[model samples]
Target: MRVMKLNEVINITGLSRSSIYAYMAKGVFPKPIQLGPRAVAWVEEEIQGWLQVRLDERS
Candidate 1:
């Protein structure tokens, strides 16, 4: 249930900042929770599940 910041997301997912936002725009990535007027964070479980799906696809 932890929240992940953009840099953490990038490091964990191996995706560029633009790519992550692009995927979100395309509705293919998990959306971040708005924390405030100037901040947002994604659910860690959601990102982990997304990664698991990708890993499953590779198998």
Candidate 2:
């Protein structure tokens, strides 16, 4: 169970920081877990699952 930082998520998903937040706001992306007063990270498995869904949609 690994947690990924914002930059890692951006690289893996090829989404800009604003786009990731926008998708979250639209309820179409996984939310991040608050790690501290100003830190957050996403579960690696959730991100991978989201990616799988996108791939499946293309099939």
List lDDT for all candidates, in order. Answer: 0.98, 0.99
RMSD of each: 0.4, 0.4
Clashing pairs in 2: none
Q: How far is candidate 2 from the true structure (C-alpha RMSD, Å)?
A: 0.4
Model 1: residue 38 alpha-carbon error in angstroms? 0.8
Per-residue lDDT of model 2, residues 1-52, tens digit only: 8999999999999999999999999999999999999999999999999999
lDDT (tens digit, per residue) of candidate 1 on 1-59: 79999999999999999999999999989999999999999999999999999999999
Give the number of the best model, judged by TM-score.
2
Off by over 4 Å in 1: none
Task: Name the weakest run of 10 consecutive residues (lDDT summed) in model 2.
Answer: 43-52
